[model samples]
Target: RRRTRLERSWRDCQRLWKWVSKKWLEKHRDVHNLKTIWFLRHPFKIRSGGEHKCFFCAYATKKWEENIGNRPPRTEKWTRCDYCPGRLVDSKFHCINAQYHYFNHPDLFCKEIERLNILRLRQETVGRSQGRPHA
Candidate 1:
């Protein structure tokens, strides 16, 4: 019979958590930003063909209807792979504002994450205090 045992100290756990969190944030920072925006009810708008510029890529999807006849409405949502680190494809690249490259732009995503975290923490603190009985 053989037995194997492993033990990790508190410091080891903390270090592992820190490393995991850093890697996770690096990968899904944009996802966090997206969630935060959803929580804050911040709208990510898609502009009209003749009017607004795309939020990502910062390019205008010109009025293609004039060139061709009426086509199916754009139902595809943009994914991170579409544009970030490399441009995958460029088709109907609609978006909200100029911050389309949120996945690549950690600075922009981090700022938004910080702002939303502040708001969420403030709300949680107030809620917790309010629920407690007077002492």
Candidate 2:
């Protein structure tokens, strides 16, 4: 007997998700609960002051400007990271694990996407078994 591609992929995704989740929990020990996790294929864009900006980047820029109102212009642009206050490169996929907490790791993002797909498939299967069409 051989395992199907989807089975193998799901197993890999589970392993990655476990590792990532553990690391996140260890680093954020104060956070007792994670309400929702969002894996966005691209950087989230929001309209701010009539201009579209990367959500994380915009937040970072706003904070920077506030702190340097009376000082000379910053030589470099402000950034934000999942674990720290830094810039988020828009070229990579973004993950919002909690409010204002963003992750831009490509590998972890891909695994999360796969995990979501697998969960959806499982839900549909269970629904069909109970004679209910998946909505």
Candidate 3:
């Protein structure tokens, strides 16, 4: 139905993402009418608590522990809802990093990874998958 670009054309064009959606932005926009915005990094950033900041990989990772905190050690791996976006050098990488973390656990997590792999495959086969650059 829609020609899927890696992301929306406008977002890719402006390099605009880490989206603060319009409804929220509209509330803040009235503060000063928001002057000529040039390049903006993700205005919101996560701060690590206590000792460690975050794990960094050659790829990126997102804030994983925030979601499923201290579970009973999953029998399957779970990706964050936001992880479909994958890693970038700048900010957002935890989605993949948590994935990698889970990927290491052969006991329970790996099996879950396998299921997700199957789901990805099914979506791709049916042409229902969305948003990825050509590899």
Q: lDDT of all predictions, in order shown? A: 0.34, 0.41, 0.31
Misplaced by over 4 Å in model 2 are 28-118, 123-135
lDDT over C-alpha atoms for residue 1 of model 3: 55
Per residue, candidate 2 scores C-alpha lDDT tens digits across 71-117 of 44544333333211211223232456532232434335445455555
Q: Where is the poorest 10-residue window by lDDT in model 3?
A: 50-59
104-130 per-residue lDDT for model 1 (tens digits) = 544443344344435544655787788
lDDT, model 3: 0.31
Best by lDDT: 2
* lDDT for position 119 in model 1: 53
lDDT of 3 by residue, 1-135 (tens): 564432332133222211212322345432112211312333322233211211121101233454466434654324433323233211333423554343232222223333444554455555644664332
Candidate 3 off by > 4 Å: 1-81, 84-105, 128-135
- Ranked by TM-score, top first: 2, 1, 3
